[model samples]
Target chain A: MLRINNLHVKIEGKQILNGLDLTVNAGEVHAIMGPNGSGKSTLSHVLAGREGYEVTDGQVLFNAENLLQLSPEQRAHKGVFLAMQYPVELPGVNNMTFIRESINAIRRARGQDEFNTLEFLQLIREKAAQLQLDEKLLKRNVNAGFSGGEKKRNEVLQMAMLEPQLAILDETDSGLDIDALRVIAQGVNSLRSAERSIILVTHYQRLLEYIQPDFVHVLVNGRIVRSGDKQLALTLEQKGYNWIIEEDAA
Target chain B: MKSPVQNAQLQTPQQRQQLQREWFQQLVVGAEVDAEYDPDWLLPLREKALQSISTLPLLNRKQEAWRYNRVDNIFQNSFDPLFDNDLEQKICIEDIGLPAIDSYRLVFINGRIDLSLSELSELPAGVILTGTAEALRTIPDQLMSSFDHLHQPGEQLFTALNTALFNDGVYLHVNQSVTLDRPVEIIYLNNNLTRSEQHVGSMIQTRNIIDLESGASATVIEHFISNNKHEKYFHNNFTDINLADDSRLRHYRIQDESRLAYHLSNVQITQHRRSRYFSTCLAFGGLWSKSAVRVEFQAQQAECDLLGLYTVGDQQLTDFHLDVQHRVPSCRSSEQFKGILYGRGRAVFDGRILVDRQAQHSDAALTNDNLLLVRDAEVNTKPQLEIYADDVKCSHGTTVGRLDPEQLFYMRSRGIAEHSARKMLCQGFATDIIESFELQQLRDYASEKIAHTLNSVESEMEHKNGH
Candidate 1:
């Protein structure tokens, strides 16, 4: 469903993602494991078309269309969703209102009828129930005073609502306890289908226990150097990234 | 009147003295004409105000209160005082943007009360609503007790001018232990300059007095509007409110004047023990406008909340100066002022809270926040807190910033366009203050007005870019 070839990215003259390439087919889950400063988050942001990131040399194809030429909003319209590692807090914007506007905007772009208030309320209630988020939280300002667990759950709730074809989960497992991780992983696993794909980026192999992946790739120095099945994550967790880095050097 | 060449012939010191004398003479003539028909008890007050205005000079940029304001630009054009005879055409309240309310309403054309447009019938017992002159003739003792006590002359140059030259205004008095079921709305429509040949550049000075006795409660809304968009006029307004012990008052001032108009208004409030005062101010239209609100705690355990929102664009200038004084023990005051400036619009906010030496256990806080949409738009905010009592707690903060780029990016990433996202953020910023209003109708009206202003400015910017 998505392909990246020799993706070269830089921020302020500093090379971050150097000659990175990855490909994912329909209905397959890919888990990207990397150490600190390995450009895992940078790759997710580059795919989402965030500003201040210069794509020096690369081509990203989503469903046979060039994704780099589209704006961030355009990418969203084309079913590209990035669950940010650190969700931004927007004061004075109601959480439910924002979500409704976003859903309607995407629907309008896709030539579908938008949901009214009643319809939206019903849809959000069901989605929110799946993530175990309170209805009161939706009435409050968007993440203004939310807790860490609540923020992560809200991100998962957004993912469930958007129902994108390609979802990039960047460090969604970080800062979450075992219980929260289980709930969030369950939320992600619910979206798994024959026509949808997810790329999970994490520094640990703990999240793969709940949501199994078809492929595991180790990203070192901005490029994926190792690719294997689910057993690869368990091996790396038992050993370490240093062994992989040494092997890559040899 | 002396010619420019003749005035130049005099020495510098003589010219200064001569100008002061001319200003004093003009003020005395206006005051004397107004005092001719006023009650006997008001003549001395008018004379005192005339003497004060004679000695006190017009405010200049040198004063701390006028630091960011160019008062001289407002005074460059000469203005004659509005008289009772200037009321020619009658105005309908509905035509001037006042919503229909099942309550008492008093309409003023220029500075005189338009009796034909007022609805003062079916008032509750012990409630008095009439023109100031009529109140002086009827309830002279009750009206005289609080007329010039809270708002005195010589406190400010404009207050002195208003006291000396104001012809007519509303005088409302609610008796002890009475609670009003509906608000009392006073509409001041500035349509005096339509007779350009006789009253061009005229000044409409008005003074409103509101007295709520002990345990009495009411809501008062003072709305100022203008009909002439191109006529250059001046509106100087003064409001005095006295909340007795255990009483409460909700006050709102809506100022939407002509683009060529100059508006200067002052509200003086004195709250007694255990009383509460809440005020919301919305300022939208005016070339140059200033609203000064001063609240004083007269006894212990009084509380007040002051909230305001002002939106200006296209070379308009708006200023708000709030002074809240905590005099006795256990009094509390809080103020929040927000402004949205677009194009070359300029806004100034100066909020000060004073905890006096005897005001132990006083709690006060002041905050001023501004949003500038364009590079050329300007905002100056100064939040001052003076605490003399060692046991008091006071805080102040000020912020001037644009919209959060991160929030913008987050909204846009949801497929909402950039322009729609910006409008949502800006509206949210302004609505945060407008939501403080207690009345639902007023809140809806204010939100609609703010949205209209934002849409018009956005369209203007788009048109400019298209050209």
Candidate 2:
């Protein structure tokens, strides 16, 4: 479903992702674990088509289409979702209003009919119930004054609402308490399906215990050094990235 | 039909003054104020105003007050000062869409009251609602105080012109201890475009008086709109609102005139002990327009809020000037104005808050926020705070910015197209002010208008920026 071929990207004349290569098939969950500054978030941002990232070399393909050429919104319409580590807070825009606009926009671009007020309320209520998000929080400004835990949960709720074909959860487990992490993992677990793919970019292996990945790739210096089953995550979590760096160096 | 001014680019101040006097003479000759709405007492004021028009300096970019607000177009255009007294031409409320509310409406068509279209039959006994001409004829003495409180022609050229050549408008007086349940609406429809007979542009001057006696409370809405979308005209209005002790007045104004028209409006409000005056101004039309609001707190424990939202696009120029005076102790005044400028559109916002020495414990603040979409679109926002009292809390701030890129990208990354995302943010910027409208219908109506105007503006702006 997704392929990144030697994607060498830079920002502000500084290289971030160097010769990175990864491919994910349908229904597969890939957990890319690495130490800090290993281009984990950079990969997510590149896939999402954020500006300021210079794609100096290589291209990203999704469903036989070059994704780098598309605008962020076009990529979104084509089922690319990036759950940022920090969701920008919109002070005046309500959470529910943003969700409704996002859903309808994606649907319209895909040549589907828009949802009216009543129909939208029903769908949002059903999805929001699965996430167990507080109804009152949905009425407030988007992520304004939200706690760290709540912000992450809101992203998961968006993932559920957008129902993207491929979602890049960039450090979704960062800064989340154990209980908040559990709720987010549950929400992600409920959305997993045979045709959907997810790339979990994290620094810890704790999230993998909640939603096990089909492949665990150890990313070192912007390249995938090792690809194995879920056991690779446990080994890295226990021993850390020093041995992996030494092996890559050798 | 021939352009009024042959050599409008006068060389010197003397030449400009001489040319202005000639134009003023043409307006005054046809005004015939003494024969219509003017009373015996107002004649001397008119004479003084006529004299002042000759001596008062013409507003130019050199003056401090007129630095950012352009009035050069006023001198270049010819305005037929004759009242649109073709009362025989019948029209409906829908013919000119404005004052979207329908409660005891006092409709004015072309600077005169169309009594047939005006409806106030159900007015309560304590409430007095009539046309300015009707009020002047029957209650001339009652109107004398309004003129006395107004700015003399010597102080401002346009105010003086309006005082000298004013024809008709709304006269609302709510008695003491009376709470008018229904809002009173004044619709100023400048509708000379349909009448092709009007080859030369028309000049309309209206003097509206709203007086609420002690303990009185009412909501008043003023809508200035034009039926024809494209035609040159001048509409100048002066609204005086007096709130007696403990009186409360909720004022909302919508100025959506012709795209080719010029408008100048001033709303002066005086609040007494413990009175509350809430005003919302939404102005987004006219080729060149300026809306000034001045509020003075006369007694202790009073409060006032002046909020406005404007969107200037294409060849439009929108300006708002606010002056709030806190003279008594324990009074509060706040002004928040937002502007969106696109294309070659321009906007000017000057907000001044004055806290006098006697106004201890007063809380005053002013904020002006603007969004300049295109490179050519311009905005000048200045917020001034003058505080003399030691214990007063006063602050003023302003921001002239484009859309926050991160905020835009956040919405765009969520599957919302760039156009929809831009429109949503711009509308959201206006939502805070639109929601301030006490009327729900007005909120809905203003939002629809804002969205409609803001839709194409962003894409047009993006296209412009690409170059």
Candidate 3:
């Protein structure tokens, strides 16, 4: 469902992602483990078509369409979702209103009828129950004054509602406790399907214990130095990225 | 209808200036000292005001207060200050969500007060609510003290002009130790019949000089609105408020005039010992509008809250100038003004908080936040704090930024389009002040109006782009 060929991107005239290549098919959960400044977040931003990142080289194809050519919102309409590392607080935009508008936008862009308020509320209730999210939070402003755990859960709730074709969870487990981590993983596990793909980007391997990715890739200095099955995650958890560097040097 | 040339000639600049202040000067011309109420104190004050109006000249763009607003277009409007004595105009008094009390509501149309709609007898026994003309006749002694207290005649050109030619407006005074449950609503409507500008100057003053014998409270809603959106009109207003010891007053001004109208207003408030004052200024319409509010805390333990919200679009221009003075010890003052400028619209906010010497332990802050939606739009923001007291906490901040990129991306990733997401962000930006209103109905009404404003602007842009 997604393909990246030698993607090299630069931000603020400094190279962040250099010749990074990855691929993911439908119905698969892929985990990218990297230390700080390994271009993990940059890769997610590039895939989501965020502006200000100049593409120095290569192409990112999502379902055979060049993803880099679309605007951020247009990329969103194409079922590409990026869960931010730090969720920005929007004090006046109601969570429910934003979700409904976003759902309607994607639906309309895909030649589908929009959901009315009643129908949208019904869908929201179901999603809220699945994600263990407080329904009152939907009525309040989007993540305004929200705790770290609540913001992460809210992101998952959005993912469950929009039901994106490719969900990129960027450092979703950074600030979450064990309970929040399990809740977030449960939300992601609930949305797993044959027609959708998931990318779990994290610095630690603990999240992989809950989501259980089918494939794991080690990112070092903006390049994927190693790729393997779930065991690679356990190795990284035990030995960390230094072992990977030692192996690469050998 | 038969003489088009004559009609065109009558709309000249000299004809427009002739209608400036008819009833105002007539009050001065027919001055009679009543034994019951003396006009002695106001005579010299009036003479000084007339001289000030004549010497200071009219507002020009060179002046900072009139920046981004056109005073020339407003001056070209011909006004009729003569009172309509027949009392034939309709009086419509309908409640629109604001609380109602036994307080009398004086309605004015085309600068004429309709006394028939007022119910002054129902007010509390000691309270006084009457027209300025009637107060001059019956209780001139009480009016003489507070008439020109805060509104210095020559200090402001418009107020000077209004004072030199003043006429019928509401005169309200709440007795000491009286706490009113409902607010006094003064409805000022501009019913312009000709293409000329509608000019109005209303004043409110207290009686008896009783300094609110401890714990007096009152609320006032002054609404200045115009019905005709297509006419070239002007509404220049001035309000002077004096809060005595341990007294509290909540003043709200809602200005929704015509887009072709030029609206200028100035509010000067002075707080005595232990007095608290809250003022909210909301401006939503006009081709060009400017408002200046100056609050002076004259005594110790006084507090002042100054809040303003303005939205401008198209070729519209809006300006808000606030000057807060903490002149005494332990006085606290805060000023927050937020606005959104879209299209080629321009908005300027200049606020100053001054803490004088001996005003120790004074806490003063000023915040100005603006959002620019279009590239062509402009916003000039300056928040200043001049503190002379060493032991004072004074801070000021000004933010001129676009919508947060991360917030926008989060909304879009949820499926909202770019335009709807932008509108929602803008709504959130201004909701901080709208929610500050304690009244639920008022907050909801403000929220709905803000929503409609954003949606209409979006639709207008869409329509303009269709061509």
* DockQ scores for all predicted structures: 0.63, 0.77, 0.61
Top candidate (TM-score): 2
Candidate 3 segments exceeding 4 Å error: A3-21, A54-71, A74-78, A100-140, A220-225, A238-250, B1-44, B57-104, B116-126, B150-155, B196-214, B463-467
RMSD, one per candidate, in order: 3.3, 2.5, 5.7
lDDT of each: 0.83, 0.84, 0.74
The DockQ-based CAPRI class assigned to model 3 is medium
* lDDT tens readout by residue for model 2, B26-129: 67666666445568898888788877777776676776567776556566666777553664556778656453565888777777777787778878889999
Q: Which digits, one per residue and each the tens of the lDDT, describe model 3 over residues A35-55?
A: 899999999888887778999
lDDT of 3 at B208: 17
Question: Per-residue lDDT tens digits of candidate 2, residues A1-250?
Answer: 9999998988899988889999999899999999898889889988998889999998799998999999999999999998889998886788999999999999999999988989989888887787777878899889999988888888988999899999999999999888888889999998899999999999999999998999999888878889999999999988999999999999
| Top of the candidates by lDDT | 2
Q: Candidate 3 chain B TM? A: 0.82
Please give, for residues B1-467, the per-residue lDDT of candidate 3 as tens digits.
01112332355555433422322343334333222332666667666876765455445456666554544444433333344334345545653333343445766664456666655556765566666667777777866655564343222666765555555566767777788666676776665434322333212211212223346787776766664666444555666567888899877777776677666676777788888888777788887777777888888999988887888888888888888888889999888889887768889898978888889999988899888877888887877678888998888888888888877776765667667888889888888788766666567767776788888878887887893
TM-score of model 3 (CA atoms): 0.83
Q: Estimate each model's TM-score.
A: 0.93, 0.95, 0.83
Residues A1-250, candidate 1, lDDT per residue (tens digit)?
Answer: 8999999999998999989999999999999999999999999988888888999998999999999999888998999888888888887778998899898999999999999999999999999998888889999888889888888899888889999999999999889989999999999999999999999999999999999999999999989999999999999999989999999989
Best by DockQ, which number? 2
From the highest lDDT down, the ranking of the candidates is 2, 1, 3
